[model samples]
Target: MQTIRLTDLIAAIEGTAGPMGDASRSRRPGADPDSAAEHPTASGAVAKESLTRTGDRAAKEGRAPSGQGESLPVPRIVTDSRQVQPGDVFWALRGERLDGHAFVGDAVQRGARVCVVDADRVTECKGPAAEAVLIQVDDTLTALQRLAGWYRCRLATSVIAVTGSVGKTTTREMIQAVLSAGRRVIRSPRNYNNQIGVPLSLLAIEPHHELAVLELAASHSGEIAALAELVRPHVGVVTGVAPDGDSSNPSISGDGRYVAFESSDRK
Candidate 1:
């Protein structure tokens, strides 16, 4: 099997550098740079892994880093407060060393347009800049997943899923190469072919993508179903499975695949 890796230039960023807001800049011509920096949200975001949006898959895999001339707008999905910049949006994810909710005041002072917070914390927070919009979510992680799923459904192009006992990655690569001839195909990074990887792929999908081909692997039962629930691939092809009940997608595809409870353990 060929080793699949993504180039740093194309890997999505989960956090950002803090830029001082105008208010802080006005405090002094050359105020303390550290003082100017503020956290991204009331709480830092979920984790860097949880900062991705639903349909913005990263491209440029396998390509060397190129110097981009202009600054790209910071996506609002960062999971850390320290990554917050004045103009960026912040998602307050509940996690270690930070609760996105705990940093709302800093985010507002630093210039966050909106803050996503746990609905449970809505009544518990207060700050001077009461103007910041607080969007309520039942569970940040689940909400993020649902948002990605919704965004995935908006595409009008072809969506393909590939599964196999052997050479799943190689087959996916071949399929990607063949489809890249004329279409703007968005293949999952490496083998982001499972439950978590599928959603990550969907988060990276762009508005202009012409195709999405996900490479799937299953070492345990029900794993495909977990991936299937999130990816909902219109087309899927499984490679092979072990007879010791170590692999199958019975519930995922029924037609051929087996689903099991231990499917989400891929690292």
Candidate 2:
């Protein structure tokens, strides 16, 4: 996993960073000067101590920190409070069945270094363990997507987006298997092809990954376009289209290499 500084993450999600309790008072050695200038709030003694403490806590919990740095390293981005680990960033997402806001306190208690929550529900996240920072955003889901898109643009990896009604997942897996022989490839986990899953998969990309094969799925109009905008794949592949499947054409960008299979049963 790539090391994501707290300041860059705040900027990427267009979120407001809040004070991080008492740990933000001391300084950690070898802090990045350029990163401090980018976001003053995360600079000097405050950021240094906060990050050091986070790393220390992770070590005590038997989890090794990803890197030794002045800047805080977010080891992982988790949506489930149960999976929260020291130095992880917990993104609160609202779903139809369960609201993540309800778990904000639980996440903080579990050693999450940061909590990204909707601005409107910020109050619900108050009174946490105080060791974590709060990032208030307009919408958690949209912010997640935006951050993933921003991160993708910074990577050197070539992305291949696979979308179609019936064979999207299989196509993505096949591509990953073939590419893995020669390159460091990352693929969508399981059938993760929807809005939430797509962004999560993209965020899981590591700095060493040479290629990414993502499966894109849509249950409604405009979803494919939205996912495509975030992916901006170097190559787009459509397996086959069916009348009952998503007919929305994927809008590919950034190189525009595309391949589509013509369906003989097209109505």
Candidate 3:
């Protein structure tokens, strides 16, 4: 018996293409090559793996992707105005004492399409970005979590969940690093290891991703468990453990780290 290498198997399974190096073939013996990719980013987003079904690609499905209405502009969710993008849903989270509700108007003026405000004093900062959807949640963080939960329910990729006082980012990066080095892997970027961070990270997961690595972090008790429930990792990896008293789970390098994950029952 003989065993074919997995790489060969994968190539056979998905098919492959070679570079079309013949300039004459492309130019049709006379066409100009300068017409290629003039305004590269004009309307082109990074080409992710295509997830559109053949039928969906050919014809309109029963329902539109973003509902019956026209596709809405991208919302700039800002924890701070500095990170604001045009047409974003500004998530006005509260700080020590300063509230996001204060800058709601300013964010709208700056090009935010909508505002998701914490419901303590949003009334004071109404108007402007007036066309924005003013959703009222008891806590902004909770609302963010709920939105992410909803998003997870809609995904099909096997989610890789990560959480630790430290090294969560490093581990998550490692997993994504290994997966994406050769494949179109979609994973969270950096230490977005918090409640809000996870959801924001999810937004980065385009339909094109075949895999995703989600980073979760918490300082207080039950933080890991709660985030775990939200992500619903079929496989879990805990990078390390910190002192029980102090709420710091630092990430480190090397395979020599304390990690816990679920496994299938023994045969």
Candidate 4:
């Protein structure tokens, strides 16, 4: 996987990066104040400085930086505010039950260096969030998926997507076990096969991973197809057709190679 910088992530998600309080401002040492005000920090110096400080702290604590860079590495990405550590990037995702926007201040208080939020909900990020860098996107979930897809393209890892209504987990485990013998393999953890889970799984892929076996699951139509676009698997597998009307077969007509496996109780 290639190193993802703050600029790279902003571009990937099509987000606008906001300043991290006054520190994000770039003021020349001897330049006129008015002239310095005219020039915003578009050179990524703020990003570099913020990440460098965070990276230094993480290093002192014996923790690795999340994403790699030339001078300053990007911080770890976290969705749950409780999981956030100093210098982590907190993505505020609005789920069906809980709204992550409500916890922006909490994440910031916990030492998140960056907060990614929906453009419309920027006002929800108050207090401590003002101290952190803000990345505003149209939709947080979509931006996350886009980021995952962008990151996936930079990896040399070969992906294998598995989809089915039944036996998907079993099949995924089987494939992972078989591939683990000689390859640095990673697979979807537990039942991480949904929209959010799939992207999280893809983001978990490291540069050293040779093969990734990801399970794709869907409770509605077109979900599998959407995920497949991000996964862009080198090999696609179907363990069985959906028992319900909604099909679990992913569209594999693109560059992905297809394979079908059938299972029946009568056999």
Q: Would you list the clashing residue pairs of candidate 4?
A: 1-207
Indicate whether candidate 1 or candidate 4 has the larger TM-score: 4
Leading candidate by lDDT: 2
Residue 246 lDDT in candidate 2: 26
Residue-wise C-alpha lDDT for candidate 1, range 62-152, written one tens digit per residue: 2211222222333434435566666554555554334567777677677664455665775554342254444445545444444445445
Query: CA lDDT of each candidate?
Result: 0.46, 0.61, 0.47, 0.60
Model 1 regions lying over 4 Å from their true place = 1-112, 121-132, 164-167, 190-196, 216-223, 245-267
Residues forming the 10-long window of minimal summed lDDT in candidate 1: 20-29
- Per-candidate TM equals 0.50, 0.71, 0.62, 0.70
Over 4 Å off in model 4, which ranges? 1-3, 15-72, 243-267
Clashes of each: 34, 0, 12, 1
Of candidate 2, the 10-residue stretch with the lowest lDDT total is 39-48
RMSD to the true structure for each prediction, in A, is: 16.2, 13.2, 18.8, 14.3
- For residue 195, model 1's alpha carbon misses the true position, in angstroms, by 4.2
Rank the candidate models, highest TM-score first: 2, 4, 3, 1
Model 4, 80-177: lDDT tens per residue? 88777887778777654566788888888998767777777765674447666666666666667667766776777888888865688999999999
If candidate 2 were superposed on the true structure by all CA atoms, what would the RMSD be? 13.2
What does the lDDT read for residue 19 in candidate 3? 18
Q: Rank order by lDDT, top first?
A: 2, 4, 3, 1
Q: What C-alpha lDDT does candidate 2 achieve relative to the native structure?
A: 0.61
* Candidate 2 regions with alpha-carbon error over 4 angstroms: 15-70, 244-267
